[model samples]
Each structure stands twice: as structure tokens, then as C-alpha cells.
Target chain A: MSNTRMIELIGVQKSFGTLQVLKDISLTVDKGAVVALIGPSGSGKSTLLRSINLLTVPNSGYIRVGDHAMDFSSTQTLPRDRDLAAFRARTGMVFQGFNLFPHMTVEQNVMEGPVTVLGTPKAEARELALALLAKVGLADKAGMRPDSLSGGQKQRVAIARALAMKPDVMLFDEATSALDPELVGEVLAVIRSLAAEGMTMLLVTHEMAFARDVADRVVFMRDGCVVEEGDARQVIEQPSHPATQAFLSHFHNGLA
Target chain B: MQYQWDFGFLLQYKALIGVGVLYTIGFTIATAVSGLVVGCLVALLRLSHLRAATWVVTAFIEVFRCTPVLVQLVWCYYALPMLTGLELTPATAAFLTLTLYGASFYGEIIRGGIISVDLGQWDAGRALGMRRSQLMRRVVLPQALRRMVPPLVNQTVLQLKNTSLLSVLAVPDLLYQGQLITSASYRPLETYTMIAVIYFAILFPLTRLAHRLEARPGH
Candidate 1:
């Protein structure tokens, strides 16, 4: 990889009423690199992931993806809903809860964005949806509803739905956290395959082993800020920040 | 005792009673359709994030739902004329009253249905780049409507029976038609019994239809 930045955030801030969530955070994600964001619950890991897609626009920030710049502080707004929608289409999000449409089949859920948002032909979208479902190892269950599927299967379908959008960047917000321990492996395996395919992925995960094994760089976050970041092995073996040391020790002692 | 269970009276007034039956059907259909439209809009308003809009819808629903349908009919038929200073036909007043009554109850039903849909559906739609309108159309409404169907059918049937209250407004619906025949022929028991049977004839098929719909796969 040439280390060209696919996503950049500078001076990002977000607050919900009186409480500040993300405070002047900045990060850069290189093209074809898997950046894992690991932190305790409520540490703004998910908030940062959402900010990248403008799902939760930062209170003040300059966010650039590829060539497009979305500055929340700018007085002038994006022209129309269409402009914001187009930007969103380029950045797909996989939610922590597998938010599959229960009324729709796995194939239909995957096909929805391609057909409705992208305006692809129904037949073409269906073919692509089936292919995506197969990629996620749910080809046999394409016709089943989300209510029938296990949590892992539902998350895989959610991933397929996002992949069907053909996004330039995929953001996973603790995507495997909702799954059972045994089921998490299959979902992580699919994600690992995507990483091998050179997909630019931003994953916020609590699965330390998967992060250690799959992430090119693991960023340890605490108190709504990045405490440390480096190669997965080095970060796991050697930590410079006191916060990182405390966090790792807690987990290692089976107290987390 | 000789006047008891007079099939001859029923047979004699069949034409008049038939017209009454038609009025009941027409009123039921009109009110139910209008109520569904008003109810859905009101439900959307009530569920809106804005406090003012939700309050307005909440007050409207509360006022209508808490009051009696007969009183509402009287108010629409009599009170509205004095307030608005506009003359309305009995049919118009009765229709408006029935619509509003059904709207309030159906609004509650719709709100419940929308709330019952999993929050995950909304998240899925948002993550898929679906705007609010698309999310409502493609995900929320479909699922919500599925959940609303059984209660909606029950409401429709209730509105059908409630059309009897329109007789007081002189809309010449089934009950009024029954009253017309009964007074002229001096057959109260016979006329009202026939009226009851006619109401059953209309509601029975509707109940069956609702049952079949509820038994379907998605619902």
C-alpha cells in the first residue's frame, strides 16, 4: 500500500446536550488498511466511527474522505439531501446490533440499497445480493427472514447489505459484539477475508484477539481519546501509556 | 303476543331496510377510509420529535378518544354550526363526527404499531443511506402496518356499529331507516330485530376477512 489517506478527521468534537462525547479527536485511515479502534464501553469509539460517515456529524470538525470534504463548522451547508445521500453511499456502516429488516429476507435486505439507492435494475440487484450473501457464507439462508437467523448470521447479512452498496470505505462499529462467542469466529473470519482482499476497513471492536490478529494498527482509546496506537503486536506487548497499561492489566486479570 | 316475531313486518319493509343497509355500508367504508388517512397523519404527528407537534396530536387524540361517540356526533351536528357559522347537512356532520372518532382510536393503534417495530429497523435503514421517507415507506410502515392489521380490522368493525349513532343526526342510515319503518308500521321489536340481523350480515364477513389476513405468514 502507498499509504494514501482514504479518511482523515481533524479536530473533531461532539457533545450530547451537557455532556461532551468526542473531544477534539483526530485520526487518519490509509487506503487498504484495517484500523481497529478498541476501548471500553462509552469511550467514543462508536461515536468516532459514526462521525466518519456523518451519521452523527461532529459538533465541529473537518472530515475528508477521498476528495470530498465535510466540515461541520462551515456555515454553508451541502446543497440538497441528494448531496448528503451520495456522500453517505460512499461510506457504509455495519451497526453493532445487526439491524436487518425482519420482514425482508436476507437477499431482500442485501438488495434494498442497490435497487433503491443506487437505482440498479431489480434482476441485477438480486444477482448481486445473492453473490454478497454467498460471500458472507449465508447463500443457503438467503430466503430466510432475519427473525430466523442467529445473531452472527444477521450481522453477516448486515455486512452483505453494506457491501452491496459498493462503498469506498466500510465502518464496522463493534460488529461482532452482539454475536455469541462461538458465532463470533465465523463473522470474524469473513471480516478477515475482506481484510485480505485489501478493503479499507475501520473496525471498532472489543474482540482483542481478532483485533490483534487482523488489524494492521490497533489504537487503544480511553476517556474519549486515543491513548496509544502502533502495530498490533507491539501495542499488545509494549505499551507506553499508563491508561493502556491499566486497561490491559484489568482484562488480563479477568476483571473486565 | 300476536305481534311477537313478525316475519311479515320484516318482509313488508325489506326495500326500506335495504336502503338503510346500503347507507350503513357506505358510511362504514367512507368513515373507515377517512379515519385511516387522518389517523396515520395524526400518528406521525404525535410521534414527531418536536414537542409542540406531539402535544397537539396528543391533545386531539385524548379529547376524541375520551369522549363518547354519541356526544361527538351531537357536537359535530349541532355545536359546530354555532361555532363555525356554517350550515352542514346531517350526512356531512355525521360523516365528519364518525371520521374524527375513528381517527382518534386508529391513531392510537397506529402509534402502538409503529412503536412495536424494533429500533433495529430504523438503524438498518439509516445505515443503508435511506432517508426518513424511505425508511418509513420501505421498513417502518410495512412492518407497522402488518402489526396494525388485526386491530385496524377490529376498529373498522367498531366504526361500522358506531354508524348507528348517526341516526340521531337524521342521516337516514340503517337505524334511522328502521325507526322510519317501525313508527309508520307500529312494529318496534320486529324492525329493530331486522336491523340487528342486517348489521350482523355486514360485520360477519368483515370479521372473517380480518381473521384470514391475520393468519397469513408475514403478519
Candidate 2:
């Protein structure tokens, strides 16, 4: 029974000046569902993921994440400090570039969110950070700086940092896109493990095989609109919409 | 005519030069600390989104950068005491003037350092739910501080040497001590030469340190 909604966005609309990035969109992910959002370049997949965390605010929307609901519309009282913080704490994000704080050790990068935002005591935060590093297979490298790590390892540390906040939902925006081809497997392994553990996650990715295997739901978007969505096998294997077929054909044709 | 190189006078006047060294070192330390602190505050304000504050900081930086430090020091000595009704000593006036002047240069250097950091770093921190202030302290400031170090040391070295201008007020600094010895002992060459050597001695090491800092790029 899909009893709980981990994330829900209704009638979300976002535009940058005259360029609309998300056009009247509604999406929902149930608790423990792994949703993979796939699209061609300029299809607004990244922008849509960012809006769920309010990293990019939708011009008009009703966003419900776990327990907090925010309305972004004219005449509404905008989110206050505590409201924004509460909203953000519910969502954790991993980026395309693996933006770890270079001056900090891997452990410190992971500990930052808990200590500063959640006010977790230092000793406890350190312990949690170490454990998360181990989970990402970087516990041995926890004392090292981000600049010293490989791109894949740095991305893993970023994953640990976001997870340290114990967020209700995790967002990945092309998290593996910046890694070397050989380095991609390690990061993908970590995400595959997260999916196995039933973490409610929304990932924007280009790896067709990995998305087909790991995601329970596959959402295909093009030109700022949801073109097709269904069970992962159906959408990835038997796409019906002309736009979705063209997009997947392009991906399989080495255009990714 | 044979010119005499006299080493004897320095031995007799070592105590005067000692006092001068103490004063110069004191001014450098005081100015470096106070100027750096105030400069950081000003840089923060200038980089802030407050439009009026940015304009005010722009005027402040330009005025200080455009004018001569010597003129500013003289003004602090002569005009400030009369206007504020506070009895001013020359040493205090010079310190205050030098610090304010140094702050402007330091502010510009720090602003450059801040601007040099990657915008992607800011976005990354915010994506992880960090507030703007948290992102700055945790992510941005650390990288910027590394870039600021060489320029900061250069400013300090300049301030240390600039303190010699205090000699114009007959302040007990190295140049003033040299002048007093020149008048009393009738040995301008020995006194001024000693002062020049001392200035070079202090500044050369700092110059080399700046080069070393420049050599070590970001890790």
C-alpha cells in the first residue's frame, strides 16, 4: 500500500525571466520509492530536482516534503528562516561536480551539516560522520582533504555529507556525470546500495542500464514537460510516447 | 678629500636605535592586527547586497587609496585633536592614521580574494542545506584566506617601513634617531646608512616570504 507521500509537488511552474524550465508539473514519490528522472539536455530534469529542495524556487507551486508544506504563490507570506531551514533539513542533495569543501577533511565535511544545522554535539556528529564515511567505503580516507580524493571518492564523501543530516528525501543531480568513466562504477555502487535499503530518492541520471536496474519508477521528461512515466521496465523497455521514444533512442544511439 | 667611514658612532648610539626599533615594531604589530580586522569588516560590507553601504564603502576605499598616507597622518595629528577636543600625541596619531590607511588596501585585497573563489562552491554548500552565512564561514572564507595571505603579508611589510614617516613628527623611530645622531655627532653618512641598512634588513625577509607564498599555489 502506497500509504505515505515522501514528496509531492502540485501545479509547479518555474521560469527564468521568459524561459520556462518547469511547466505546470505535478509529481509524487511514495515513501521508499526510488524514482529516476531522465531527459535530454535542456529538458529541465535538473531544474525540477532542485525545485523539490527549494534550491530553485518554482514561481507557483504547492510543495509537500515529508511533514512540511510550502506554498510559493503571489500574496503568500514567504518562508521564514525557521520554515526554510525545516524544509531544507528534510531534503539532502548531491551535485554533479562533487562540491566538497576543499579545506575540510572528509570527516569534517560530513559532520558539518549535523553540527551546524541540526546542532548535534561535536563528539556525536564525529561518530556519525565516521560511520557514514564507512558506509560510502571511505572510512580509511576520512582524515584526508577533498582535494586529495579522486572524483568518485569526493562524490562519495559528498553523499556522506548529505546523508549525515538524516534527510527524509535524497536528491541527486547528475551526481556521476563529472566522474571519470572508470570511476563511475564506485559511485553507482553506492547509490545502488541506497536503493536496496529503500531510501526515498529522486535521481537525474544518464546511465540507462543503471536507471533501469535500480529505479522502481522511471520518469521521462522533455522540453520542461513529463512526456512519459511508468514502471521502470515499461518506460525503459516499451516507451509509447513519440517524445519518450525519441529521447531513449537518442540515449541508446550514443548521444548521452 | 678622503671620505671617512666611521663605525664608532653606532656603538655609542646603539641605545637610541634600540628605542627606535621598539617603536617601529610596535606600530607594525598594532597596525597589522587592527587594520586586518577592520578591513575584513569593510570588505564584508562592500560585498554585501546593501546598495547604500556598497556605495559608502566604495567612496571610503577610493578616498583612502587616492590620497597620500603622509597627508592623512599629518591631518590626524593636527586637525583631529582640535576638532574632537582630545589631546593627541604624535605616536597615537600616526598609529591611528596608518591603521585606517592600511585597512583600505587590505579591504581591497580581501575583496579580490573573496571574488576569486568559485561560484560552484557556493552552490554546493547551499544545496546541502547550508545557510548563506554558514556557507561563507565553512566553505568560502577558508579558500579566500589562503589567497589573501601573501597580499596581507605584503601590506604588513609596507606598514612596517611606512612607520618611518613618523620621524617627521620627531617621533622616536629609527629615522628620527638617525637624524638626532647626525646633528649631535656630525656624521650624516654613518647615521643615514645605518637607518637604510636596518630598513632593508627588516623588509628583505618579508619580501622573500611573499615570494614563497606566491610559489605555493592552491593544493
Candidate 3:
């Protein structure tokens, strides 16, 4: 493992019954780097993102964060509920659907994780939540419920909720896929600013332009394995792999 | 036909009607409040993670739902005291039967409310690191209750009508009192009409309120 690497995976494998979803996936994320995973639907982009937080455990893999390696496949290994819980505190994830608690006000949704997960005092958590909402430019909508917000604003609140935990690394699992076309740009801009601020991110996104513009590196995947990996500029233009070349050509020219 | 309808006899027994309406109103309110508490607890148990608790609550719901309220009322009023050697007056038996009957119906209503809530709400609560109890209190139940309002009002109306059945236990509720008045005055048509009018007055406003709540946005 490199000294500056924030996440390291070795021979990570996952399966659903007899069907394999992730096959011998090994990757490294350097500190403060944005890595974009892009591929066709059902190519395991979301699975790869979820596996980092153990939301979807791998069948056989060694996942290392900072200096700690948590083995997911061992039947004998036991990580207590609290231990797994504490581990999740360091990673923030934004879902495709903007899964805000409908019962809570926008401000309460952001404050929830800090107070419940981290046991921060209510007053302190409230302050931190407000600051995060301000960062996403949703401070004025704090008193409203998520149902009242536009799609773009809801996604921003979801982003603020994830950031409230003060995570070291953030994962975006197709965060803009469910949004309307016009709403996509606002969410993308917020994510772009996070990258500019040196936040480590692993995004599973369909936005080719975003991957090209903001990602330090891009991994092109097919059949649950990365077929081509390189700098975003090289992969998006002048790709070496036939799969990558064919996939990109389809979207660019309306011919698959 | 009733000896020229004996309109003055109707006027004479008006006090009895007033007291009867009070008893009916009091019983309905008390039972509805207690039934809500019973229903919520049983619903939670029915959805319990433990198999034993789930089975127990499921059996309870099934038994109460399938049996007629009349039979249950009679059993509670007559058989319970014999079996347990604990004597209860007619009012106590009527209250217990109402509580049990209302609970089963309300349990179904509450379960439907909980299920109608979006699945993502549960996932969001888990992601926020809320415990099962906290998730229910802060996220799931609030949304469920909001969705439950109309159905709860319907259940309460049904319960108010069901209170008339308690007359069999000689609880001196509205219908029982009405029967006593009619027997003395021999004016069933006039007495029953008054009782019906009183029930309409209580239920109509609640029905309208439920409709108004349902019409609101995000309801």
C-alpha cells in the first residue's frame, strides 16, 4: 500500500448466489483524489462504491482504510455492531434517490447523523448542520421538509447531510441519475466544489463531461471488471481499449 | 298511531335521553383513547423481530378480528368473572370489550399506515444510525400517523356505533336508555329517532374533518 493512499482493496470479490458481481477487484485511492467509475448499467459501479462502507459486503476481500484492514469474508471474524457502526462514521455516502427523512425538517435531517451516530450534543450538532447547509447554499430552506424542496435543492440537502458527519472520504452512487436534466447541474456543481476543496471522492456517475472535468482518474468497467484505467483525458479521448472506444462512440454519435 | 303520537310523553322523558347520550359519549371517548394505546403496542408486537412475540400478537389479532363483538362482550361480561373469580360490574365489562374490539380494528389500521410509508424512510433512519425505537419515534411513526388520520377517524366512528352494543351488558348506554324510555312511554319511533339524531350529530363533524385533512397537501 502507498503511504498516501486513503483506501486500499486487495482481491475484492463479491457474488450473489452463483452470479458474480465483482471479480478480483483491486484498487487504490490516494489521499484527496477524485476517482470516477463509469460503465453501462449493471456493470457494478454502485456495488463498488457500496463495498467501501461495507453496506454491501464483499465475499472475499481485504479492505484497508488508513492503517486498519477489515476482513469482510471471514466467518470467524466478528466486528461488534458498535465497531461496524463506528467504522461507518468515517465514510459518507450520498444515494441516487436523495433519501432524506421525510418526517424531519431539512435542518433536522442534516443534524441527525452527527447527534445519533457520533453522540454530539444537540446544540453543537445543530450549529454544524447549519454550517453544512450554508455550504450547499440551502441555509434558507432549513425549516422546510424535503417533500417541499425541488429536486435540485433536495439533493443539495442530502449532500449537506452526508458532509455533516465530517467524513474523510465521500461516495456518490449515481447521485444525479434520478434528477431532472435541468436539476443535474446544481448537484454536479456542489460536487465539483467538494473536489476543488480537496475532498477524497469516489463517484459512480454517468456524466461523461463531469468525469472528464473533475475526476483525477477514471476507471472504465465492463462485466464487473475495469477494462481500462488512466487519467480522465486519456480515457475519455484516445482510449486504448476496444470496449472503451466502442462505449464512448455510442453515446457521442448515437451509434452503438 | 301511538295514541296521537303522545308528543308530551316525548317531552317528559327528555332528561333520560340526555343522561344516556352522556354515557355513550363518555364510553366512546374512553375506549377510543385506550384502544389507540393497545392497538399501537399490538401492532409493534405483530411486527416484532422475535418469532414468539410475533406469533402471540398475530394470534391475538386473528381471534379478536374473527369473533363478533357481541360474543366477546358477553364472554367478558359473564364468563370472565366466573373463570377468574374477579367480579366486574356491567360498565367494566363493556369497557373491556370495547377496548379489545377497537384494538383489533385499530391494529389493522395502524399496520396499514406503517406499510404505506416509503421504504426509503427506513433506510434513511438506518443510515442516520437510529436505533429501532428511535427510528420508529422520529421517522416511521410520525409519517405513519400523518397517513393514518383519516382511517383513525373512521375507526373512532365505528367504535362510537359499537358502543350501542354494550347495552346487552346492561351498561345503561344510549340505546339501553332509549329502550327504557320507549318501554315506559310506548313510543319506539320517536325515541329511536332521537337516539339516531344524536349519533349523527357526533359523527358528521368528524367525517368532515377527516375529509378536510385528507384533502391537504402531503396528507
* Local accuracy by lDDT, each model: 0.86, 0.88, 0.85
DockQ of 3: 0.30
lDDT of 2 by residue, B91-195 (tens): 888888888889999999999999998887876777667777777888899899888999999989989988989887668988888889899998999888898
Q: What is the TM-score of each candidate against the true structure?
A: 0.93, 0.89, 0.84
State the lDDT at A178 in candidate 3: 93
- Candidate 3 residue spans exceeding 4 A from truth: A1-5, A8-28, A54-71, A75-87, A102-105, A115-126, A143-148, A220-246, A253-256, B1-3, B6-19, B79-89, B217-219
Residue pairs in steric clash, candidate 3? none
Candidate 1 TM-score over all chains jointly:
0.93
lDDT tens digits, residue span A127-172, model 1:
9999998899899998888888998998899999999998888899
Off by over 4 Å in 2: A1-3, A15-18, A75-83, A254-256, B78-89, B208-219
Which TM-score does chain B of candidate 2 obtain? 0.94
What's the C-alpha lDDT at position B178 in model 2? Answer: 87
Model 2 DockQ reads 0.43
Model 3: residue B189 alpha-carbon error in angstroms: 1.8
Q: Count the backbone clashes (under 3 Å) in each candidate.
A: 0, 0, 0
lDDT string, candidate 2, A1-256, tens digits: 1349899988899899999999988999999999999999899999999899887878898888888788886535556645666688778899998878877889999998998877899999999999999999999998898888999999999999999989898999999999899999999999999988889999999988888889999999998999889998789888999888877886675423
Docking class of 2: acceptable
**Top candidate, metric TM-score:** 1
Considering TM-score, which of the candidate structures 2 and 3 is the better prediction for this target?
2
- Model 3 over residues A67-124: C-alpha lDDT tens digits? 5568866664545555555566678888898889877899999998888777899999
